[model samples]
Target: MGILTDTTHLHITTWVVAVILFLVAAFMQRDSKGRKIVHMVLRLFYVLIIITGLALFIEWSSSDPMTYGIKFLLGLLTIGMMEMVLIRSKKQKPVTMFWALFVLFLLATMFIGFMLPVGLDFF
Candidate 1:
């Protein structure tokens, strides 16, 4: 419990980094080698984000399972939307819808995360 006692910073850091990487990868030329590298790095951040998020959830969710559960699901949906947007963009398909959903879900997830007991309480 010691190491995992407070994973909030790690979780938030992962999300921030993942978002930046995703944006960078998404805007790069589809066939560029640098885009491929950034995409791979973004994938790694995805894994790190999931791991840190799960750690925080497991550590603090007992206090309010329902809200935490919703936040968790929203987080997953946000991640899925991000990946879908990137994939569709790379395939030269229309990504406007996925981009919209990604923004929606990401904002919702952030709101919930901030409202949680262990969260920033900014909202």
Candidate 2:
């Protein structure tokens, strides 16, 4: 497989891209054309994040199933929060809670990813 298809590479890259797109979508003006485009792109990023995350989880779950399990659930929660924020923003509703949860889950996911024995020097 080429470098792009590598699970670890894809996982990290997608996470970063997803976060960036999430922020853009979150901050865009309500009901604006730009916001719509950004939100659509953000949805694609979410899909990439899930796919790459699950690939990594399956690879690492054997040795540390407990950690991976928690991370997996957190990942899902993070994605859900992302979607919630978008919906709330589109409706012009307050997204404070959803934003908080999104940040929390995103950070937790990164913390776990960083601590894993991936042997990468990203830090």
Candidate 3:
């Protein structure tokens, strides 16, 4: 397959890993060691997601400055909210709001991808 197709596949796989990590980090109530391990794994997954996402973005439509700019801003906001959720207070409400924002951004990204003729030209 082409590089774009391969990259798309990898991107989807990385997202799946990210989702698993999110669930583990959000729901798992284990010992300190286990929690640490989960946190480490989630951090690594986040890095991979960012890297692959950038690669995919470059491959898809680097020619469109506006789309790229929007994507970059949204990505930064998503990551920032996730970091806040992880490191801010132990309070549940703020954490829930962060996760909710993360999910909303994720869904927004998917919707944009589906509706726009940009990434992968899949539609």
TM-scores for every predicted model: 0.95, 0.87, 0.73
| lDDT for model 3 | 0.65
Count of clashes, each model: 0, 0, 0
lDDT ranking, best first: 1, 2, 3
Model 2 RMSD, rounded to 1 decimal: 2.3
Better of 1 and 3 by lDDT: 1
Q: Which model, 2 or 3, shows the larger TM-score? A: 2
Between candidates 1 and 2, name the one with more favorable TM-score. Answer: 1
Rank candidates, TM-score, best first.
Answer: 1, 2, 3
Candidate lDDT scores, in order, read 0.88, 0.81, 0.65
| lDDT score, candidate 2 | 0.81
Evaluated at residue 33, the lDDT of candidate 3 is 65
Q: Which stretches of candidate 1 lie over 4 Å from their true place?
A: none
Q: Give the TM-score of candidate 1.
A: 0.95
Kindly list the per-residue Cα lDDT of model 1 for residues 7-34, writing each as its tens digit: 4777888899999999998899998999
Q: Between which residue pairs do clashes occur in model 3? A: none
The predicted structure with the larger lDDT, 1 or 2, is: 1
